[model samples]
Target: MTMTVVPAPAETGHSVAPPGRNRRVRQHWGATPYLFLLPALTLLGVFFVWPAVTAVQLAFYDYRVVSPAEFVGLGNFSHMLGDDRFYTALTNSGLFLIGMLPILVVIPLLLAVLVNLPLRGIKVFRLVYYLPVVTSMVAVAIAWNYVYHQRGILNWLLNTLGLLDQPVQYLLDPGWALPALVLVESWKSLGYYMMIYLAGLQSVPRELYEAAAVDGAGPWRRLSSITVPMLRPYIAVVMVLAALDSMQVFTSVFVMTQGGPQDGTLTLGYYIYDAAFRHFNMGYASAMGLVLWAILVVFSLVSYRLTRGKAAAR
Candidate 1:
């Protein structure tokens, strides 16, 4: 006997995941980012946000270690208005802003351009440049003491080059101390800024530089046109960071100068530390901190304005 034949049902092009699995996947996508961000958010709140709030509260109160906190009602700020040391610290911070701006922003970009060249041993040059970035500031400061000594390498070099009539006590001279600190700060951080600019440089298309060269454009022209325009975002970022760090300079000052040599290198940051810990003036220190925060905001705004341009961004 002949058996009846039947055709199987046609298969659909797509497989339908189970409803439970689909729901689970959607839930995972929604929750995963928040889960990843939870730790960082917690840390930020604990460290930065909480401290900021506490500082604001302390700014309005006279909180000393010896007694209970008393409400001051801006007395600390009014006192800050008359503090001579405060003005001196402000002036020193401004000088740092000026001295480090070019050294940190412009010079690093130029150096990055040089090191970005396709040449032998370029990686070695990058490493050498970046070594100082990883070096501890305390160690660097200690080493620089010898460098600034009367019979030190720096003095010898200056004398040999006829730049100095004699070995001037760099960190000891009131007129020279601030500038010397500026130099040290710049040298310590130059490598880090260079790496930033170098990263930006490498991200730029090789074809642009080659095309510019083919059209008889010089290195300077190509850099001014292609490199600058493309690296606008990086420039803005670097400028803000440089301004913030320069204004908040403390470690080098604390380690090397202790804001001494007639308080020539007394930056606002060091002064804040001094007021808070050394003199037990928490309210005053908090007030000064708020002022410094305002200054940082202003500086960041100015830096962004200076570097404002349409960037061929990453």
Candidate 2:
């Protein structure tokens, strides 16, 4: 052996397989993705899944924070249906959603299109439009609170313009409270939705627009024939987002009106907060939250189905 000593394979740059053999390696690499996903999956299970399950379970029981949780079995649902306040909140939520949907959806699309136009300083315009989106909701609510005040800048501006005979109680009057809140919510959300639409618009092929132009189609016609059809997914996304945001509207009502003036601005979201924190009915509040979640799920499913059906029809 000493007379015929040979170098070990480690010292030489030789391997068992041929060069570039890495390309022949199995690309699937099964189980690696799942292994990497384990931490996130465990966190989701512990944080979201378990809590949601417990909330649903507690919903069937009549358990206040201070009282024993007694199994009620749909009693909360029955009570909800029978309660006038619940009905009022539901109605207000419906009205708010209806009033805000068009503004939330249409305004953003228009803004996105406008900013996407081949014009100078469009980036500046985009920044201006997106400013509201990044602003804090609490700050937005507070600013709007002052604006809607009877003796605030809004009234002053109206007075300056001679638009009204006197100051209006925007948040105090039942007739105006919901609508006022809706407007503020739409304004705050418009920038975010507009950004989403902008991204979608950017993804749309410019060749289609050029082709439409070659075919002697005008801007509106091109939009109808090409832009709208291609943007169905984004539209669906906006609708669902607007609906969810509208359903979960709370901060504006809390800060601006506190769901006051005969509970005119009381939404389901506000009701949950009121029940849970204000009244200290934690168990009942959890039940209400579960019910709210069910309602939201139904609304979401219906909206999704309707939007998808329309898209499919085309």
Top TM-score model: 1
Local distance difference test scores for all models? 0.91, 0.85
Per-residue alpha-carbon lDDT of candidate 1 for residues 1-314, written as tens digits (9 for 90 to 100): 99976544435355677899999999989999999999999999999999999999999999887988999898999999999999999999999999998899998999899899889999999899899999999999999989999999998999899998988898999998999999999998999999899999878999998999999999899989999988888888888898888999999999889998999999999999999999998988999999999998997787666666434234
For each candidate in turn, the TM-score is 0.85, 0.84
Distance (Å) between predicted and true CA of 237, model 2? 2.3
Reference-based TM-score, model 1? 0.85
- Model 2 clash pairs are none
Per-residue lDDT of candidate 2, residues 1-314 (tens digit): 35866877767777566545654554446657988999999999999999998888877887777878889888877777787877788888888889888999898998888998989999999888788888988899999889999899999999999998999988889898888899999998888999989899998989999999999999889878988888888888888888888888888888888888899999988998898788876666777788778878987897789678877886
- On the 0 to 100 scale, the lDDT of residue 137 in model 2 is 82
lDDT of candidate 1 at residue 168, scale 0 to 100: 89
Global lDDT for candidate 1?
0.91
